[model samples]
Target: MLNTGLLELHSDCQNCFGLCCAALPFAASSDFAIDKNAGQPCPNLRNDFRCGIHTELRAKGFRGCTVYDCFGAGQKVSNLTYGGRDWLQAPETAGQMFEVFPVMRQLHELLWYLREALAFRGAESLHDSLKLMLEQTLMLTTLSPEELLKLEVHIHRAEVNELLLRASELARSTARGQLNPAPKRQKNYGRGADLIGAKLRQADLRCVSLRGAYLIAADLSGADLRHADLIGADLRDTNLSGADLRDSLFLTQAQLQAAKGDLAAQLPGSLQYPEHWSVKL
Candidate 1:
């Protein structure tokens, strides 16, 4: 029921808590050559609460810092939940702030998907279903911190899955049931090509043209998409988890944050690795 076209439903990080910097941890790896623990501030975090090395994070050996997105949870939790108080100015709120960060992050992730689900005209048949889910997700935002943190996300996600499958069925009908059908050979695309819900996991989609493509809910997890051209692409809810997106051109930070990516994922030079992943530590 929110305005879906303008991405208005998503978070604006500039107005956020800088929660991504404070809540997540980092380690010495290709992405970040440090061993900062969870909930600790980055050394480069500035007095004004911005990353001091944001522009040169890669050269500074913090590559993962360039690719991370909190889906606007950072700003909302920082400003709304804490009443515009930064942790440095109110040190006593540290524990509570960290605890609330992940809850808001999870809520924002659902919002990203719900917003995407509402945007697909191909899924208009399932709009009512998506509308209900969106309403439920919006209600979660108003819950107390304890309730929000204790919330079971998989239950709501399961409900969304049923509707998503039906939406895929409707979208696929237009694609003639061929998911990820090879694009034309000469750097071009035909009018009304459908790629919605296609399984592109680990696919080699380098240097390809995807103008105005419908990529809603497409599983791009683990795909090597270096240098791919994605101009005017509809990428709502397309998974990029575990995908190698290094050097992918013209992909915006807003787009990357709108999709899901875990620790196993690779990102552009601008983002960093997620500190919350439970790898074999």
Candidate 2:
């Protein structure tokens, strides 16, 4: 986590070893143009470690590539953990590097969310604990490849998640209306619920838990998602026109990229509008 002056927790391909392309596997489905096994270099991966189809990925039927976010794991594993020993130059570390990449990705994702919850409004009481967990997660990423592979990330994740849930509850409670009275919230969102193509336009979803929900192709136009926990929610093809997510919890760039959105939608300050989102809104 040494400062590289790059936006930490965001992908910076220039400092990476194309680990995602070589390490990740994808099937020949709607997202991918072809099937690729783990550790196999994508046919489109160039000698310089840049995607050959960078501009044409979606057009070339690799739509999934466009939505994928490594959350800075590529550069971290390549530059920091492995000490810039790329698979091409070192060769022997390739397998271990590939294995470690996903582990690092998960740890980094957790770090991102912890930091989010730490800064969230009305979550001040949990700040000390959040900072400690963030530091602990950061220290885990510095372990050797073998150590990283052996690490039981889920256990750490569960502990962190419990803390995060408390933070979420605290933050959301502050948003609960005492005077003017906010809209009656939508129902509690179970993880991985099938919400594909469900009509939910203009819904009041304040302070709800949409964690790991499948919101693919769901119409969420003009919905108010303030304080909603959206970690791991599949937002692919979810319409977000005019939706208010300015205070939503754990929303990632990949989610926004996978979903359809426009300028009219408000996002958390940390997130930027996806390039594909329409200016017309």
- In order, the Cα lDDT scores of the candidates are 0.65, 0.88
Per-candidate count of clashing residue pairs (backbone under 3 Å): 11, 1
For model 2, state the Cα shift of residue 89 in Å.
0.8
Candidate 2 TM-score, C-alpha based:
0.94
Q: Candidate 2 residues 1-281, lDDT tens each? A: 43334326889899899999999999999899899999999999987899999998888999898999999988989998899988999899999999999999999898889978888888899899998888888888888898999999999999999999899888888877531457584576777888889899999888888888999899999998888889889999999999999889999999999999899999988888987886754
lDDT of prediction 1: 0.65
Which model scores highest in lDDT? Answer: 2
Q: Model 2, residue 254: displacement in angstroms?
A: 0.7
lDDT for model 2 comes to 0.88
Q: Give the Å shift of residue 230 in candidate 1.
A: 13
RMSD of 1: 11.0
